[model samples]
Target: MQDKLSKFEKAALLLLMLLAGIFGGLIRYFHLKYGFDALGLAVRGNRHAVILAALFALITLAFAVVIVLALTGRLFPKDAVAVGTIGAPTILLSALSALAAAVGTIVTLASAVKQLSVWGMLNGILFFAAAILTVPVVRKLSVRSDSASPIGTASLIIVFWSCFRLIEVYRTVSSTPSVSVYFYDLAALISLILMFFGCAGYLYGRSGAMRVYLTVAAYLFFGTVSLVGKGGLCLSALFSGAPVAMANVTDVCVYLYGFLFALAVIPTFFAPRRADPVAELIQAAAEPEESGKEEPPVL
Candidate 1:
């Protein structure tokens, strides 16, 4: 039985992602900038432990659902899984990330290096190099082959940045790091390692980095929501009179990648599955021979 998703089905899922990702992202950004939760939903009184556990459960369940849907051809035909197509959103995001990273880093480095001292200057340099590494996003507009290097490198930089970014929020529960904060850092580290191998392997002409790229994407998703509703701990403290770090200006690395990859996975992975030619040939040959045989009498 054919089990491919109709356009409407695909649209509905995109809408869900839009609500959960894009709209939810805006709320997080707003809270981070303002240092206050308008909705008053911040977890308090040592309950963050429970919230962290529930958060992982939700993310794990969401990932599993996406996997099952994609693999079973519910999201797209399994036949088309091999030959994926590019979408506009992917291109737009690629362009935006590249430009934002390049321009943001350059501008900030120029303006803030004098005031930033050595550590900030180093961060500015590192971030600038990382930004430059994202060239493939704009130049090639795809993550296949050695081209994955840029994104792989960028993912590593994001992991490095998150280390500094999440330090303030790493609350301790029973002398252990809070699950929400620590888990995200752990995911970023793992993705960084995977992306390194994926990119290195690709350099040797091996394209074993697709899954690694997805992992990075997943980590980015976590990063986008890491500070949501967590007042006073947001990396971006625009309205709270906090001094913004130079790196924060170029943080499009995490935000932009998260948005792009989450959506890009859809078009790059989905297609109308075409029937296997060899299988069709075999079936055709077998069918003719079976048809040549006499039919059994009906009972």
Candidate 2:
């Protein structure tokens, strides 16, 4: 109906959204590697690592609130509070859980190479698998004309966060000399690559006729980033004698950059497009004739 946003306004908003995603990803990445407490939290939890995790949890909650408010004022405004409240908590929890897993993996591995027993390693596998399973379900869900499904979008966010941590696990454990050890890390690394591509395809509007091609491309992009982040971490750790803190930070930098690049697609998906009111009017006029309606008297 009304064009509330000028081209400049639209461009600026798009840029802001992209920045938000990048910053958000960076925040999550840092929370994962260092433990929120280590990042400068005054009150620490035996249960929680840092005040930062709680703070990030709060930030994710805010995103949920804003998205809910927008949806409520627009399409689903009536149920906005309920949806936002219900879904926001999940987002917060998922982010926290992901961070915890990363911290756990790093601490466990760093303590000694032998600490990653069969069960510990298996737990990591399951975490990675849960994320991998989510990819297909997410891509299968129908995105609405105006917005991505809340559930689907949230799942993707979880996938990225978890998969990133899975990469962290690999970076930590691969330093050990055990051959059996490297296999799991290697597999997780490959899995991360696969998931990234799938994410890219779903973002690229590849759900249509060219779905197969798009899926492959999406997976490929994801794989490339996974490889780069992991490979870089490995090479750097080799030279620097990676303390756990620095290793975590290296992981954060790699993921931060990857997410930033991935975020560029967000603008194209949400960008403004041209419309034709005249054609719509002409079509409306012809509809009455086709329905056998007589023209009214001109008087």
Candidate 3:
């Protein structure tokens, strides 16, 4: 049954990647000549969209291949569990996280340059550090022997980052509260909080971490809704003769983020419970010892 399920999952993943590739090709073909003006600069609209789609499709295909190989026990031979539990998903998530952080750093740096604000400079530096640190952290986590430590550290970092981002979103909303934006921010904030607690529980050897998969699923769902829904709204406005410019870069990032989250959730759902050495030791210690008395003839 497990083998059958694994086969099914691999087939589904391959199909998904194939579809992504086809969709990307179609979009590129249809929008080949599209162009637009942005900030007094002429931009190749179709080119950007085509590149984004192609890149997304390529990455998806690569990830699918990696997953298939891992599932087949061809990758990370000495650490199959780690590959399934953390390594594969970490590749996608960490790459996306780093990309997002890099974008944020660039934007913050630009803002600081324009405003000459010390705080903006500091914020930009922090973003840069996050972008640079993500790779090493993810690498360490991927190869770590114990899963709990890496997960706990990652979750804690996510919680803090999410809190900061949420605060920024709230401040923006307070000035001009849009329901859509607020909903997106709220979903993310809740997801991060749940993940934080879940990881914390797991680190402490509690079983409740298993339940956090639901929250992570919710997070991925809402994030998809927010990004795709916004894209849909942009299309609607465009068709309605509004001159709104959509950022393909952001769209690509969001797509990768959603895809990685979905994939990450899958392994988490199916991963076997790892044995806790401490818990086993305690159990053994608690067991009553057998008496060493000499046998009384009958024995």
Candidate 2 stretches with Cα past 4 Å from truth are 1-51, 74-261, 272-293
What order do you get sorting by TM-score, best first?
1, 3, 2
Superposition-based RMSD of candidate 3 using all C-alpha atoms, in angstroms: 11.3
All candidates' TM-scores? 0.52, 0.34, 0.49
Q: How accurate is candidate 3 locally (lDDT)?
A: 0.48
52-112 in candidate 2: lDDT tens per residue? 2454355446545644544345422222111001133333433443444354445444433
Instruction: Estimate every model's Cα lDDT from 0 to 1.
Output: 0.46, 0.40, 0.48
Which candidate number maximizes TM-score? 1
Off by over 4 Å in 3: 1-84, 87-89, 117-155, 177-181, 204-207, 231-262, 273-299
lDDT score for residue 238 of model 1? 49
Worst 10 residues of 3 by lDDT: 75-84
Q: After superposition, how far is residue 88 of candidate 1 from its true place, in Å?
A: 4.9
lDDT per residue (tens digit) for residues 216-287 in model 3: 443444444344444545455567776422332333343334344344444544444445578899878766
